[model samples]
Structures are given as structure tokens and as C-alpha cells.
Target: MKVAYWPGCVSRGFTPELHGSMALVGPRLDLEMVELNRANCCGAGVIAEHNQELVDTLNARTFALAQQTGASMMNICSTCQGAQSECQQRLDADDAYREHINTHLEPEGLRYEKGGDWSNKNLLWLLVEEIGLDKLRERVVRPLDGLRVAPFYGCYIVRPTGRLGYDRFPHRDKYLEHVIETVGGTAVEYAGSHKCCGFPVITMAKATSLRQAGRHLADAIDADADCLVTPCPLCHLNLDLQQPDAAKYVERDLNIPVLHLPQMLGLAFGLDPKELGMDKHVVKTRDVQRKVAELAAA
Candidate 1:
């Protein structure tokens, strides 16, 4: 299937591995990821607080760009998905507001018509709903047998059900768990699986952010999970990149490796760890790699 892929700012900059892994996995799953290279940022919710109109305009511009592709828009970042989806929902409901936003795009020759032929869905939704578990299972050349994976949903992707679709399909709450099992990995149940990773408040309250990140890591560790996988790059930043600082806040050495959703899928698809950018992670993924390798060899 063809999709207008929105890599988002974080995936392109902060977490290039997520983008790289997605590139490697998309073709393997028969997905044509036509990147919206000219697309701008989704405001990531920060801009919405300062200027709602600006956020709406920016997202509307992106939607206009996606419309030209003649395919449904798909985001790899949860923040981008939430921000754009929220704006799209509002624009679709209020015709006058959408027209106001379109005025800003008129100069660029772009128009985002509400209730158009295109819709938006994040990578997680596409994987579970569009691709199907049976199709994913068939593509798993190297099953992650004996590996325990903790699913970290973070926020944005699952909440505000009206915009993100949890109200229509409650089963989406278990998408990460289902994907884990499809790749032959045991889904480790933990309290922090659906909780926020504290990325939003990291700048405003450093200590609180650290505590939240540490607690999530601790919960996954306490559950005996081999590694934690998250769909949001911001969550991965808090849980993986900031883990050392978070360990100081919680008074424990929290060194659990955090993998992006695509990276985990790439591993199961028999892709190399380096190709998936596993070595670039702050918390080393060697343990997870070793476990998967041993299982595949056996």
C-alpha cells in the first residue's frame, strides 16, 4: 500500500534511528512510504499553547501537502500524529475555521479541504490495522523468541480518544503487546506501559521528569523485561537517552534499553542491528541483540 509518510522533526533529527528503521522495514512489508519532504513541523503541541492559529495553519499546510500525494498520511511520531490529528479533527468539524486556516496556505497555492479523500494514521495503527498480524508474522525471518519486551504506549497516541481513535477501537491499547507476540517476543505487562514518559514536562520540571522516566524504567525492570519498546520518539528520549540522569533521581541504576517500534520490527525481519541504528542508543541494546541472536541460532 502507498502512504504519505511524515517522518516528523524528532525522527529526522533527535531519533534518526526511528526513520532509518522505518525505511528498512517499509519495503519489507510492501509499504510504499512516499515521504512528505517539504512538510514542516506539526508544532508538537508547544506552539499550540502560544498561538493556536499558528499551530492550526502549520498543520493545515502539512495536510495540504499530504493531499497532493493522493494517499493517506502516516506519521512515525506520536506527537506529530496527535498534534496533526487534533488540528484535523477541529478543522473537519468547523468549516469556517478551516477556511480561515486555508487563507494562510493560499499564498503557497495549497488548500486543505476538510472531509477530503485522505485521512491520517500513525505507524502503530497502520502496522496493526492495515498490515495485519498474520502478514507481519509472515515477514518475521528472525523471530524474537525468548525475548521479553515491555510495551510503552506513552501519551498522545492512545489518549484524547476522540482525535486519536481509541474510542472507536479500544483494542488499539494493546497494539504494542500484539506486535511483540507476532514477532515471537513475550509481552511483559507493566504499570508504566500506558503512562506518560514525562517528555512534555522535561524542560519545565527537570526533577519531576526524571522521576517519571525513572519510575517507568524501574517498572519495566521490575517486571523482568529484557527491553522496553515505545512508539513515540519523545518517550524514547526520556526513557532511553535521559536514563542515566533519571537513575540519579530514583536512586537506582536504570539502564534498560529502549527500542523504537520500527527498530524492534526490523530486528525480527532479519535486519542488522547497525542498519537499525541500535548502536546509536544511549542505553546499549547488546543484551537484547544477544538474546535474539541466541534464540535465532537455536
Candidate 2:
């Protein structure tokens, strides 16, 4: 399936492993990613606080770029997916609003036309909807049989059901668990799986963000999960990159490995850990790697 792939700022900059892992695994799944290189940021809901119109205009331009590719839009970042989807919903519903946004695009000769077959979805949605779980299971060369993986669905991807397609995909909440099971990993159900990783408020409330991250990590550990997998790079940034700081806040040694969803799939596809950028994570994935390796060797 061909898609106008939008590697959001977080994946492209903050967590390159997430982006790299997707690059390595996308072709294996026959997902042709036509990157929207010229596209600008989706604002990730941060910019919207100051200027909602500006955010919509920026996203409309991105949609226009995706339209030029003549393929459906796909985002790796949950923040980007939510921001774009929200804007797309507005544009689709309000004709006058879309026309007003198009005026800004006129300078660049780009206009986003709604009511087409074109759609916007995140990588998780693509894996479950476009590439069926049954098909994905068949492609697993290295089954994660002994691994207990926890699924973390950060706010944007699953919430606001109307924009994120949760209403249409009623069982979408379990999609991550299905993928984990398909890869032969035990899905560890935890309370923090669907909560925020606190990335949105990190800049303003660092301590609160760290506490939230610590809570999620502790929840996963308490649930006996070997590792946590998240579709959102921002969540990974907080859960993995800031884990040590979070430990200080929570008063515990939280060393759980957080994997980007693609990295988990890459491992199941028999791709090397280094190839999937697993070694680059802040919270070392060595334990998860060794466990998977031992299981594969058995």
C-alpha cells in the first residue's frame, strides 16, 4: 500500500530510531512510503493554543502536499495524526473554513479539496486496517513467544474517537494487543496503557510530566510487562528518554524498555536489533533483546 508518509518532528528529530525502524520494516510489509519531504509541521496541538487559524492553515498545506502525491496520508507520530485529523475534520465539515484556509495556500499553489477517497491515518491504523493482523502474523520470522509486551496508547491516537476513527474501528482499542499477540508476545494489560505520557505539559510542568511518566512505567512494571510498546513517539520520548528522571520523581528504579511499535514488529520480522535501532534507546533494550534472542534460539 502506497502512502504519503508524514514522519513528524518527534520521530524525525527527537527519536530517530522510531523513524529508522519504520523505514526498515515498511518495505518488508510492502508499505510503499512516499515521504512528504516538503511538508511543514502539523503543530502537534502546541501552536493551536496561540493561533488556531495558523495551525489549521499549516495542516491544510500539508494535506495539500499529500493530495499532490495522490495517496492516502499516514503519520508515524500520534500528535501529528491527531492534529492533522482534527484539522481535516474541520475542513471537511466547514466549506467556508476550508476556502478561507485555501486562500493562505494560494501563494504556494496548493489547495486541499475535501470529499475525496483520500484519508489520513497513523501507522498503527495502517497496520491494523490496511495490513491485516492475520497477514502480519504470517510474516513473523522471529516470534516473541516469551516476551510480555505492554501496549501504551497515548492520548491523541485513541481519544477524540470522532477524529481518530475509533468509532468506525470500535475494536481499535485492542488493535495493539492483537499486534502483540500476532507477534507471539503476551499482551500485558495495564491501567496506564491508555493514559497520557504527559509530553504535552512537559515544557510548562516538568515535575508533573516526570511523575506521569513514572506512574506509567511503574504501572507496566507492576503488571509484569517485559517491555512497553507505544505508537506515539512523544510518549516514547517521555517514557524512555526521561525514564531515569522519572525514577527520581517516583522514588523507584524504573528501567523498563520502551519500544516504538515498528521496532516490535521489526523484531518479529527477524530484523536485527541494531538494524531496528533498538540499541539507540535511552532505557537500554538489552534485556528485551536477550529474551527474544533466547526464545528464537529455542
How many pairs of residues in model 2 come into backbone collision? 0
The collision pairs in model 2 are none
Candidate 1 root-mean-square deviation in Å: 0.9
- Poorest stretch of ten by lDDT in candidate 2: 158-167
Q: Write the per-residue lDDT of candidate 1 for residues 213-232, one digit (tens) a residue.
A: 99989999999999999989
In candidate 1 the C-alpha lDDT for residue 42 amounts to 93
Q: How close is candidate 2 to the true structure, as a TM-score?
A: 0.98
- TM-scores for all candidates: the values are 0.98, 0.98
Deviation (Å) of 249 in candidate 2: 0.8
Off by over 4 Å in 2: none
lDDT for each candidate structure? 0.91, 0.91
As a TM-score, model 1 comes out at 0.98
Question: In model 1, where is the ten-residue run with the lowest total lDDT?
Answer: 113-122
Off by over 4 Å in 1: none
Candidate 2 at 56: error in angstroms? 0.5
